[model samples]
Target: MKSKLPLFFFLILSMFFSACSVNSHIMFKTKKNEVIVDNIPISPADAYRLAPDDKIAFTVFVENGKRIIDISSGVNENSAGNQQINKTDNIQYLVRNDGQVELPLLGLVKVGGLSIIEVQEKLSQLYSANYIDPFVQVKVTNRRVIVFPGTGGDAKVIPINNNNTTLMEAIALAGGITERGKANIIKVMRQTTEGRKVYQIDLSTINGLKYADMIVQSNDYIYVEPSRQLTREILKETTPIISLISSAIVIISVILTLN
Candidate 1:
């Protein structure tokens, strides 16, 4: 009988080469759309509102009719303003589920749906009710954005130090997206007063620069969708195992024939 070894080897080689060629074609076809990315105009980010589990710190100042630049001179009359709390002292207040934050003397104050500036104003008004004048400056301590790089990778929570973190910076921090990740189809999900919003970004063309400039917000989800060729690549990865199994079977058959 004609040897089956040659035919078996030929089939394996052909399948491998065919898979490689198809994968290459898919890569080119999918990337062609990416290069044609059009500019997407995005509006400015709305003021970030307070949410549960957010840590906020505020510094309260009580004006003492001072006119000096330095306000740390033992609360003197010449000082700009007296520090209600210690300069180094800061209360890391956590927003509760009830949309309220406990303060030293203000008790449970509703802070949900309020921006940092709004909270500062509200606290100033609250403290003014008791004291002469309360100057409050509030800021969020922990701000972060979540990133999902796709390709079966785990999600990553990246901290936003500047609050103005761009799309590219966020992806870079998450290890710059996987090879199977389609950058042009990236999605940024945000929670707004109207409801949840999703923004699509394309990074392959210069026109995508505007979208990339969109500032990242806390609790935002950045997802990089995997390429359509993912299935082909996965199937290609299994080819080696199939080839090994077939080679082993061929060797065993030859040994039996010789015996």
Candidate 2:
């Protein structure tokens, strides 16, 4: 019996393991396009806007290289612009009360709601008034990402160096989402002087790819939640005893079929 018992146990063990592999564990009915239902969809990029508290750096072209060279030499140090990069050839400003940033030579100008490119062009036109052929370059220095609470998010703020960050990009940076993360349900919360606005985004559909053009701004929070299917699947895999039984069943089946 002992000798035969080993064979029996082996067969049973293999079968048990195989059972687990087949339908024992991680078994749940998911809708069609399981991956889509399971994952966060990306949105399309129509336009990227700006908000307050966003820090920006601007550089005005010094045609004769005198202003550029002078500023680059560290003569007049700008607090905001100096914090931006290595030299004073640039102007740094945060979006203030009137959605404007005060510049050294250019004074205050409203920059919110305008894209970086637009800002550069506008600055060029504005600076051209003072400097000849002023070539302007503007960059968003401090980009803030928002994560919502109660969903797959935490009430936290993430800072980004580049302004061109997207929804997915933001999520990936924040340790991705938890297992219970609801990918399909993501919200990009924004605050404006008028009021607080919420841009609901679907990170799990093709349509989301269209809206994903949501360029993350400074102090904006993005909240992610878990989908039902993903939550269920996660719960199933976490069962220790069930997984053990499944493993045993698989081992038995392997032995029986091979024998």
Candidate 3:
């Protein structure tokens, strides 16, 4: 039995190395000059344009004595001195097929190819034309990105509440990566006018945070790859069962020979 000790050790060592040497696909490798230095300003990317079936919210800003009110009052008084339900209670402006939403004062405003900031500026201008010192705030209420955490985890849609939700933020909002997830390998898939664009990001290193800090776009697909550690753990768990089965087979052979 002791004579097999060297063979057992060799097999174990081979398996360990094999598990460790599993090919892992990492993303966003640091460039030659990609060093983490201070005073590096990160400019935010452009805002998302409104699409069909997208929901938007328009808030009228009012300034008072040292205080500002966001007219999101959530309630609207009717002309008949009765309280009427406001369908825009949540400030959701449903974008119609014609790429326009009818506002209270401004009718059929075109907002298809415009960003949230651009829409806000346009709304502010429209409001100022009619109302006194109108300050309009426009936003896309239902902006979201889908996250695909590989390894059989449930895919989730992460709402982009802020216009500048980053890759790390999306991961965090989706309850972070799973135990089988590889932090070093992350892909962000975004749709462009020409075609779909994919961006790879590695978060295993401190410098990789630059890529991880990249802004996520609406309807973006984020995928986190599986980790090799999970495969190693599975192999480690099955090794004992395999050894037990082999021992049982050897015992049965000995018993049969004795019978």
In order, candidate lDDTs are 0.71, 0.59, 0.67
Better of 1 and 3 by lDDT: 1
Q: Rank the candidates by lDDT, best first.
A: 1, 3, 2
Scored by TM-score, the top model is 1
Per-residue CA lDDT of model 3 for 1-259, tens digit only, reads 9966875786677666655645434333334344233332233344568878888876565331122233444232333322222333355768898898877767788998788788888887877764556566676778899886755446699898886678888888888888777777676766666466556666878988777667788898888877556566647755875687579769988999999
- Give the alpha carbon lDDT tens digit for every residue of 98-202 in model 1: 899998767999999998889988987987875567677678888899888755555689998886788888888988888878777887777888786666677
Model 2 / residue 177 / CA error / Å: 1.3
1-259 per-residue lDDT for model 2 (tens digits): 7756875675566655544554222222343432232233233232345567777776554563234422234343233444434553244578886788877666788887887788888887886766666666677776666664334324466777665677667777776766656667666655555454555556566866765655675666676644446434444544565566569779988999999
TM-score of 1: 0.67
Order candidates by TM-score, high to low: 1, 3, 2
What TM-score would you give candidate 2 relative to the actual structure?
0.51
Q: Is candidate 1 or candidate 3 better by TM-score?
A: 1
Task: List per-candidate RMSD values in Å.
Answer: 7.0, 12.7, 8.0
In terms of lDDT, the poorest run of 10 residues in model 3 is 62-71
| Model number with the top lDDT | 1
How well does candidate 1 score on lDDT at residue 208? 74
Q: Which consecutive 10 residues in model 2 have the weakest lDDT in total? A: 35-44
Worst 10 residues of 1 by lDDT: 65-74
